[model samples]
Target: MMKLDFKNRIALYYLMATSVISILAFVFIYFMVKDTMYDSLDHSLSYEARKHLSEIAVVADTIYFTHKKEWEETEHREVQINPVFLQLMDTEGQIMDKSPNLKEDHLVMNHAFSGDTHYNTQLKDRPIRQTQIDIKQEGTVKGYIVAAIPIESSLMVLSNLSRTLLGLFPLTMVMLFLISRYLAGKSIRPISAIIHTTGRITKNNLGERVPLPTQKDELYDLSTSINGLLNRIEEALEREKQFTSDASHELRTPLSTLRGTLEILVRKERNISEYEENIRKSLVEVDRMSEIVEQLLFLARNGQASDPSLQQTVALAVLVDEVLSRQHKAIKAKQLRISMESNSWGNFEVPYYYGSVILENILGNAIKYSHMDGRVVIELNGDPAGCYCLVTDQGVGIKAEDLDHIYYPFFRSDYLKHKQIKGLGLGLSIARKAALAIGAKITIDSELGNWTAVRVSFDQKVS
Candidate 1:
């Protein structure tokens, strides 16, 4: 079956409910009337059957007439002998007495005894609901009294009832239908209001919220969830707008600088060495601008840059070893003996491309900051609460106050803040963002003169 929509579903529900109730009511009335009417007829038939039997009582093996309530006082030749109908018969199949409706004194083919109490015989002209009963005398089969009454009254009552039902049925159904329609509308008003409110809201017009239905039913719950979803969407939209504005501001100055430097270099042709030096410096600035733009794009995209095929269940222990070994070139070039520790649960089920990038940035930062021939203890493991990759480098570490600002874009440690560091101070920021995308948290602990230990922990439990 095809599904019914809400309006029709409500209509059908009302229709079935009313139909059941109406049928029960009609059937109850019908049965009650029939039973009560039959009881009254039965009582009258009992007396009539008893009286007719008494008149045909047996006396000395011969049937004698007794009761004569229905006998004529005088005979008149002109007046038609009232139809001989009521009769009484003997056990030997002899009729002793009869009303004027009978043809002979005894029954012809079939006989009814006095004791025949209650039974029916049908007639064709109309329904003839008749009853026959027996009349007995002193334990002997005597005679019968068949008391019959035409079912004219029952027919008339039923005919009237049927007519009344025919006339009233359509009107009752119409009334019920109207009642159902009204009820359905009343029940669905909240839904209609919700639709109206929802129509008013668009992507650009998320400020409008649906009003909770006053009834506080299912509609209220629906409204609350929709409103919460809209709130999240609005927040995301605002973040995008802010990013667009900040990106323009951040890119504008670098582009102008690169343009001015290129213009100056192109104006005059210098000798090879001088030209080479100037061009390298100019290229460095250009590279800085390029890196900044790439970082901004990377931040904007977040994890959208990840290739789905690169995702795999990787061994974190092996990853740590690989990163340490890879960073050995940069590690020794920076002149630091970096230690290694491994106790991951054991491997990370993640993408390899993004994982390598995350490790390179983190480890590269440690090597860059480490002192010449200094100790950089790299612990790949932690106790209990999940795995850890801790890199504590012995170098001019972060100032106590600058720790919080270190992860902000273009923010550097006080020592490296003024110096021409290779990065625009976004390596830690990018590493933290990538960590977040893959479900990890980064923590930092440092002192001005001691060491800077950056911990990228694979948290045992997710918040």
Candidate 2:
């Protein structure tokens, strides 16, 4: 067996349904016509039998026609063109009299039949519609009157009707199938166009979008959804390209510094103090490159699927204190002032690794970006609804326009102006991703060169 495509399938289904209805309709029409012809013949035969019986009389114990001229009628005498035959028979089944048209042949009388009834029988080897009536005197059935008419013309009409219906059925179905197939093709033309358009789209042509249909139906919705998906893919690809370019530039700077320092050191011999300073400088570049690689790896790993078992109840205040302690050296170097306020909120259920990463990066950014002797506030506030941790720093804050792009990996606002701040821009990006993994949200509000506040809100809690 072969499989049919959508258009052919649609046509076949339509044809199947129509075929059932057409078959029933044709059968009904043929039967209705056949019944009509039989009914007309029966009525004519009954009338003829009644007329002949009216002219007959029963004398004592015998039956005979009172009017002899009834047998001389043209219809009774002729055997051609709508000929009707009449016969009379005794109770014992002997023929008493018959029409001249019947010649030597006689109509059959069925003894098994009771009352006046119409049926089909043959006379002289020709088909006929017949009816039988009993002649009686004082409730005694002395004889029976049988009347018949030829039915060959009516049979021929019915046969021709059946043939016409049978022949036209197949032809009509063929035409219906063709029309249905054509309509189905036109209906799905939009889908074909969508497939063609999407097939041409590649990474290089991600901006291409599918054309929408004129009607705002299901196909239009499908086209709109595909275009929306393409938009997202194009955006993600662009961000990926930018991230790669930034990562390469950042890593290359440290490598060049290391290479240049080593080349200078190997060029000529240096005294102990000069050698020590150069070695320390080279170590600083090596450490910077190592930090960049480590953060890149952290971002990549955080973006993957996390294990559910790693989730546990974590005290927000404790996590905040630990992050601050880890960044003590940076705070001390900048002489920054740290103040923490907590409302004694209980531990919340979260992925521990992701929670720690979120806190570590948020606090680290506060300490790194704050000016010397500037104040930094850490607030932990919670209710039965949710928990919020806010870290605000009074430092050279980010510009209002660049706030939206801050979450992009390796995105830095005013890098040349903040060159003294030695760090990769992946802190906030990493923190945001970690927060998302634990079903948390991060919001930042900042003014250029004034102050910045970062807030992490957790919607999940330990019951």
Candidate 3:
């Protein structure tokens, strides 16, 4: 299992995400306020510029008018306190009219100007920022008017805004860090519980289950499923323990009987005539034990079918013939007549022992469960899909409801209870494993009246 670092990384990610979002929001608002403030400043400067145009004293002979001294007084009062101050330069390169608070310097070199623009000039011995505009009548530039407004207030507003944002940013970052930590704890609690419970389940501690919640959210559902699996694993381990004990007990009886019988037969003066029969019975006992041991090893090895060396080319006909030959005695005694179905020999590349174990299980099941005069039929066919092997027997078949569980370990049909069958219900389970190891499938079709027919198919074909 992979270990997860649940606290620091989670908190960091949450904090980072929130900080990014908050900073982006702050930036958006800052720009909007900046544009709005600048627009208001520019509008006020332009409006005052238009109003201050009327306060100008036009001192030309053709444009002579009364109230010249009043205009001069008005310009002095208007320019002293008003925000928008104006400076007028003549075409003769001289200072024509300068407001009361305005300077005559820095206005030496300038030409016709219009629209809106910025310039820096020394006014009243201070550098003043100015926006220049031209007064035009009948498509001619009369002169240029430079409107100056102090940018100190705007700079103050922006500086205060920046300070406020900088101050709030750190505070908000701290708040977001705390919030991320809290949320990470809430979200990762279930995982922590799962980890703690999993840690408690060490070797031979299969009985324990993962902690779960009642809400059945995604994590809860996952925990619930794992708990259910642990229960099954616990039951399976318990059953395996019992099976080992049962097998030991079962083998001891046969071995003890054989030992006693052999002791009697080995007496010096006794059982010279019973030597062959005694040897036969002893061999039978040995054979049965050997079979049981082989089955147990098969069960153990089935879990690791990913071994690379097991891959091979298996001829279906050759495998079937081999299994049949091994059961020669049983077949002959039962007078069983069998016929193979394939027109030509076909092979499937699969695990080395796939067809061997599969045929052994099915055929052995047929032989063990068949009636006095029952027949077993086997057929192999190739279609567009790879190939299939079908085993049909006249023996008792499984019921519909019990069919699903028949491949589970030690799972046998109800018919086996009354019939003379001697198996621990591992043949079908092993067969199913072998089929899966070879990337094949086993499907059963049977009824109460007729016998069972198991079809094994390798669905994908090579040449």
Q: Given candidate 1, what's the lDDT at residue 260?
A: 78
lDDT of 2 by residue, 1-463 (tens): 4799988998899999999999999999999998998888888888899988887777655666677787688887888878889888888887777778889888998777766788888877888888889897778788888889999888899989999999999999999999999998999999899999999999988988999999999999999999998987786676567557666988998889889988998999989888899899999998888888777766655353346665555687777777788899999999999998887563544456777889898888888888889999988887666888888999889989999999987788999998988778889888887776667889999998888999888884421
| Cand. 1 Cα-lDDT | 0.66
- Angstrom error at residue 350, model 1: 6.1
Overall local distance difference test of candidate 3: 0.70
lDDT, candidates in the order shown: 0.66, 0.84, 0.70
Poorly placed runs, candidate 3 (over 4 Å): 1-5, 17-32, 43-82, 89-96, 100-116, 119-128, 132-144, 200-243, 258-284, 303-318, 333-336, 339-352, 365-463
Q: RMSD in Å for candidate 2, one decimal?
A: 4.6
lDDT, candidate 3, 1-463, per-residue tens: 3454667577777777878998899898888887887677677767766666665545551111233453465534464443456567654445566555444334433444446755445556554456666655557656666667666656678789888998999998888777777888888788889989988896577877886786879999889888887876776676577558657865786799789878978676555457888888889888877776667557645343556666555677777888889977877777777777875535544344666888899888877666657788889886777788888888767789988999877678895454566776779988987887667889998885568888888766421
Pick by lDDT: 2 or 3, better one: 2
Q: Relative to the unseen true structure, what is the C-alpha lDDT of residue 325 in candidate 2, on a scale of 0 to 100?
A: 86
Task: Pick out the ten consecutive residues of candidate 2 with the lowest summed lDDT.
Answer: 297-306
RMSD of each: 6.9, 4.6, 6.9
TM-score of each: 0.68, 0.78, 0.64
In candidate 2, list every pair of residues with a backbone clash.
none
| Ranking of predictions according to TM-score | 2, 1, 3
Task: Give me the displacement of residue 38 in model 3, in angstroms.
Answer: 3.8
What is the lDDT for 350 in model 2?
48
